[model samples]
Target: MMAFYFSRLVEIFPFFLRGLWMTTKVAFCSLIICTLIGFILGMLRSSNIVFLKRLIGTYVAFARGTPFVVQIFIVFFIFPEWGLQLEAFPAALLAMAIMGSAFICEIVAGGINAVHNGQWEAASSSGLTKLQQLRLVIIPQAMKVIVPPLVGQYVLLIKDTSVVSVIGVMELTRVGWVTVVRIPEGLMVFALVGILYFSISYPLILLSNYLERRMAI
Candidate 1:
């Protein structure tokens, strides 16, 4: 039976590949969205402005404090009542964006804050506008501190794609669950799922390590 199920898993491997593609798309799109929003919010978060900082703080707190699954449910199930009807894929992406951006925001804020205050004062003395200071002087330096953990967060985001399966996203983990129903080989099915996940995340892990070393210089 084990041999038969193993062969069955091999036979349906294409199904898993399709699921892998979906996961990739979700992760890629979410990464872009998270990075953009995270950077913007992070800049605001590290800013001296009291209202913007507190407002973003509240959002970051809520996002970090809540379970991701609950966030998905709220996006997928609750939003319809508010007259925002989103399909599963869009809803999954939205939930991912919200959750991911918050974490990334904190990472960006930490990175920006790590820059010496003298650097900011120097930039100001150079007569660069605030935006120019961040773009030209601050962010460039912060990238060294930011890139490693940011890559690490990306790995976590990719793995978190599995949670979207609860909203019917048909991602890799969802494929594994469906395959288990047919193959009735829970261990075999999920083991393959785990391998696929590793394949996706492992590259980012390598890149993170490389960035850590390179950035350390």
Candidate 2:
């Protein structure tokens, strides 16, 4: 079986690599959209206005509470009823971004809030407007707090990309499933898949640790 499988490994190698590439692409696209939307949501989250805060709160809560697959199905199938049509890839990307952004927003807001009131007072005394304080004073300092958690979120997003493959996104998990089915070795297939994810995720965790250390945290 070992000799026979050695031959099959060569056959499996190329498809596995292709699947990894596709998974990376989906994760990258989702991260960009999520970060952009999250910045907006984060800013809104810290606003003094109650209505704006509540509006963002409702969105964050719902997006976080529901499962991503459920969101994906809803966006792909349900939106057409409201004249909002989206294909599978776009729909999946949209749902992933929204779910990620909600979490990112909370992370950012928490960081901002951590910057004590004294910091805000000092910035205000220096004639910094609210916008200026946020841009120059608050955000830069808050970034020290946010960076570690944000890195964790990014790793999570990479793993979560595996879920999108349920919609036929051709990501890493889908590719592994295809390989496993062909091999007739459930354990071997899943074991290889786990190794592949570990290979991707471990480096990210190391990077996060490095950044935290550099921050002296």
Clashing pairs counted in every model: 0, 0
TM-score of each: 0.98, 0.92
lDDT of 1 by residue, 34-134 (tens): 99999999999999999999999999999999999999999998999999999999999999999999999999999999999999999999999999999
Please give the TM-score that candidate 2 achieves against the real structure: 0.92
Model 1 stretches with alpha carbons more than 4 Å out: none
Model 2 stretches astray by more than 4 angstroms: none
Q: For residues 3-64, could you state the per-residue lDDT of candidate 2 as single tens digits?
A: 67657966778887888888788889999999888877898798788998999999999988
Using lDDT, give the best candidate's number: 1
Error of 1 at 18 (Å): 0.2
